[model samples]
Target: MNKKRIPLPWTNVYGLARTLVALGTAGTLAASSAETLFRPVATIGDYPSCNSTTAASLFCLSPDDYSHLTWLKWLCVAALLVIASGWRPRITALPHAYINYSVFSGIAIADGGDQIALILSTLFVLPALGDRRRWHWEQPQEQTPETRATRLLALIGISGLITLRLQMVVVYLQAAVAKLPHAEWQDGTAMWYWGSNLDFGPAPWLDTVVGPVITSALGVALMTWLPLVIEGSLVVSPLLPQWLRWWAMGAGLLFHLSIALMMGLWSFALAMAGGIMVLCLPLGSTIRLRADEDVATVDTSPSQEAEPPDPDRSAPSVEQPQPSR
Candidate 1:
């Protein structure tokens, strides 16, 4: 009997799926970290947590609500690592990738606003697609190139981490800038307002420690001017002195962590964790490519060289030039 062939629509349907996954990874990692860190995690005796007034439904995420978020965050990171190792990520990743990206479709679809979940989906899309130019209609069983896997993995290393840092900078900067318009933020009153908020149980004393007068002024300062300074520095991180940039990075984490503790924005904490990617950025390629990182190569062949090339072919090939004849 002759085998009947099946047709594949690589574009529109399948292509879109891939794009969504890339964006989802970035957005999920970034947003989840922020959401998890800034907002409290699921707990007893509370309505669901929502991060934005724009999506109040989002605010009501349960312990289960955040399940997909954290799961996707780590899963993407893991997929990136495995892909970089060229361990045939397609075999294991497609399943996890689908789950990592797709679960939130309903939530995003249900609650509209240019698809926030889509943001994460878009971020992760490039890493997952392997080689868009190389894509061809084929069965899932078709062998995936190790080069494609490796390159994609490398992209995850670069883009995933970089995107997270950018997101962190954006988050803090946006918060800081938004504070600028608010009279309270300018005078540091917003900080006090946050400190004074009683609903953030088990921590009423934390925000209120400062007398109301100081609270009011600090609130304005934090809500207003601080964002300008943070965002300004964020713009300059690339050009700023390495030491200062590093300190800014540290201050960012500490400041956010403090917010998490006092304001109880647990998702924000998680977002900060995602931003942990920034710390890794300073390390030279030696460390990041895992050359300095001692671990078993994906290919454990004893004869194969463990050291990657100076320009590792195994690393993600952003745009491969045709080899010179």
Candidate 2:
């Protein structure tokens, strides 16, 4: 009995990571646009047309950027999100693809590192990304010419993902560079300033226990060096001992969280943190980990192998279970 051993590079892991980047790019764009369209009113007096000008205003003083919703964008975003996750229909997935396309194009036109990566990836990369629709058809019971073509398309999707990863790497390096010249970053004082800012949410009182100077000093080194460690180490990320990468990723997540909190870049933090997780975790394990997490079983084991299949090639046909939210 010959059980075909597909190489790790060709497995479902890359599929998940790439999908996340695409999905995330789409999400980030959608959210940022929404915020732009529906930002908060400067003061309560500005809400005359918004609601009755009464003291006991039933509505939220500053609803989660509510005034920005248009039926069209919402509908389109809904369609895209569904398409990004749908299992049985490519048509449903079209909106997600279109949004991804738009994002990539927009990013490219902007010429910044993030946008450049976005444009390049969307144009040359995402066509091979797969969902259940592609994979289900390739199974033994369902294999057909149509299925094979879809699988080939999935390959294209994986190619886009490769560019997407390259894109993410560029962002990591660029951000690290941005923080390089600041004396505060070198001394950790910049992080302390960031931590106390209101945009990052209220500063926690607990920080008083550790003198601000000490905290700031530690923050400066962390702020300056963390990205270097993560981005530079990426060459060996999937190759180094799994524990080492995981440790690095966890630290990266913490750093991103601090960025989100101190600098008020929450969405950016989340997306970057998610990206860090995507890059650091073995490409082949996402679907399994997702599935296991859903069923309330957690796998804590580490993979010793360093070479994860390049999701850029094999990612498209892997199945998606349920959308995370």
- What lDDT score belongs to each candidate, Candidate 1 first? 0.40, 0.44
- Tell me the TM-score of model 1: 0.44
- Cα lDDT tens digits for candidate 1, 4-118: 2211111122222333333434444445452343343345222232334423332233354456545544655566344323333334335434433343331331221123333
Q: Looking at model 2, which ten-residue stretch has the lowest summed lDDT?
A: 135-144
Give the poorly placed runs of model 2, Cα more than 4 Å off: 1-69, 84-94, 100-155, 196-216, 219-224, 235-241, 289-325
- Across 11-46, the per-residue lDDT of candidate 2 in tens digits comes to 334433334434545455466554343344455223
Using lDDT as the measure, which candidate wins? 2
Question: Best candidate, TM-score-wise?
Answer: 2
TM-score of each: 0.44, 0.56
lDDT (Cα) of model 1 = 0.40
Clashes of each: 65, 18
lDDT of 1 at 279: 32
